[model samples]
Target: MKTVKQGDSGEEIAILNNALTQAGYSVKEGMTFTPALRETVVAFQQQRGLEPDGIVGYHTWEALLLGGESEATELADEDFSRGALLLDCETAALRAVQEVESGSRHGFVAPGKPTILFEGHIFWAQLKKRGIDPVQYAAQNGDILYPQWEKGHYRGGLKEYDRLEKARAIDREAADASASWGMFQVMGFNFAACGEKSVASFVAAMQQSARSQLKLFVRFIHQGGMLFALQRKEWATFARLYNGPRYAENRYDVKLAKAYAKYAR
Candidate 1:
């Protein structure tokens, strides 16, 4: 809990907010530090083998920097191509579920028959990369569970239309491809600049982006700062920093917040 000196960017402050919220600490929108926040920050420092000074200083920052290294290492061992595929598929599935939750009146669109298999395979592979047993999770809950298709062909029925639509929604959300590619669709970016225009190429870029985000999150947590303070998480804040605040709030922030809370944890 050692504190920063004057004139720091308060990066550590942003990190603190992320870690606190992830660990179930109550935080306000502005990341204003109250007496309780200070106490919690101090306690988190102590837990992480930092000094108990209640200030986010160098030692705490150092530990935070190192804490996510192992997690990164684990991710590094993954077959990223396969990982991307799985992530895309799971995203589609989750989106489908979300659609149901949202009460979309139309029958859920099934992700492309071929695409579903591709997405599911990729998702399962990614799950394995993270050391999560996808089969186990699939078996436990019918809704959240991954659907099993024979040779990637889903048997159609009355209720299935709804289910497929839900799955398609998840695919769209999970897809790392450009917006022009459509839901769970990967393509239509400057892929040639990166190397190739194949799905594999797109997957590689997506993985790189995902890895970058993971690094940023770890850095934020290590610095013991508030991401919101830096205009990182709040839709308006992110919009102001990256895009326009109004667009960020209206289009991106809420979705990102949901994903961050849902998948990044």
Candidate 2:
């Protein structure tokens, strides 16, 4: 993310605009950071205990992305035990996967928002699946509408919500399906596998808390036919399915094995 101020115009500003709106500040969604938006930013900063400099810098961005939500709700050991029981796997196995998938003890990037990665290429494919040509919107939104999956495009952390907000503007349903959310990193398109009726509902459930995410993860593994592999400690097979065909490129299986070993002890 870059520093955004009055007179600047771009996706960062647009993200700021959306943040302000989500934070309960009345602001129009657009790229230009006008005087009105600045006032809202300053007010938001003040309310959030920031410097109120009217500049959307790092701290301001953090506050806005957090959206005034309270602390993230953590999962208890009993939560993991329940998930393991449902999956017929050892609790350590679930713990290992959770540790590897989220790379954190907690799943949220903000108070209420789950960790997310918006895949632009997936958004393009999802739009096409719905008979919507992503190319038509490519001119103005090249960042979030590419035709092929490409690595390294991730803005990472809360900035991923920026990509998500932009993609949502293009097509909400497809945009929702394009993100991998929460501790287990379940793709929204796998809503049915996670026992959700719709992608929108899946996203809603993901935002609920880490425990909800864990339940969805268990459902996904069971429904997706990966329960046996998980229970048997089949790291290679589980990694191939969970992380995609090129899982070897990042040694996901090896990482999973190492993590599982540590927790199983």
Candidate 3:
């Protein structure tokens, strides 16, 4: 919880306040960790027989996450339903994909946000659209945000927060599309394809939980016209459309084939 206390600020503080409110405590509308927030924390801690330190530590996090039934269990059910509906596959396929992609559904980049792999192709497109010289950008950023992966020192599935932030500086829409989001790593630019209104909404949905991540992924597959490929176990077609035209060289289809075989067994 980032060691929340009075005078602290930002989204984490705001989230803590919201959790307190959901647990039947009052909180002001904002991100600031005020004196009242401390009081509320102490009260909650006291009720749970914890030291009234007025700080959100590990114990507080446990209480907040598991207080009223487990969100994890609920999210898992949603993920399975959504995956089955969209991909026409069972949980095994989905689990295998998750295992290959992010190691786990909870492999978060930030609190409540899934890790992402930034796309150089999307960055080039965004830069060209803005009339910005991508070559010049690559020259300055050292390929960390461009077509050449090595220039960025990226070694597959690395967290690209700096790259994403740079893209956001250029354009939010492009930034959203430039990074693959969630357990499925669906590109953010696919927000509309995923049935989202904007990048912000897509990011918020991505931050909601793994269930929402899976839902977003299903929508992406459906909108991209790749659902049939997955349904028929045509990993070549699915990987090509979903991963890009270079999926063959990347062996994404082969990987998906092996993952599915492991799960289908």
Whole-model Cα lDDT of every candidate shown, in order: 0.38, 0.82, 0.70
User: Which consecutive 10 residues in model 1 have the weakest lDDT in total?
Assistant: 108-117
- TM-score of model 1 vs. true structure: 0.24
Model 2: worst 10 consecutive residues (lDDT sum): 63-72
**Alpha carbon lDDT at 29, candidate 3:** 82
**In lDDT terms, which candidate is top?**
2
lDDT at position 146, candidate 1: 51
Candidate 1 lDDT by residue in tens digits, 116-160: 112343344445554666677454324423543222333333343
- Each model's RMSD to truth, in Å? 16.9, 18.8, 14.2
In what order do the candidates fall by lDDT, top score first?
Answer: 2, 3, 1
> What lDDT score goes with residue 224 in model 2?
92
TM-score each candidate. Answer: 0.24, 0.71, 0.64
Identify the runs in model 1 with alpha carbons over 4 angstroms from their true place: 1-12, 65-265
Q: What is the lDDT of residue 81 in candidate 3?
A: 43
Question: Which of the predicted structures, 1 or 3, would earn the higher lDDT when compared with the native?
Answer: 3
Query: How many residue pairs clash (N, CA or C atoms closer than 3 angstroms) in each of the candidate models, in the order given?
Result: 32, 0, 2
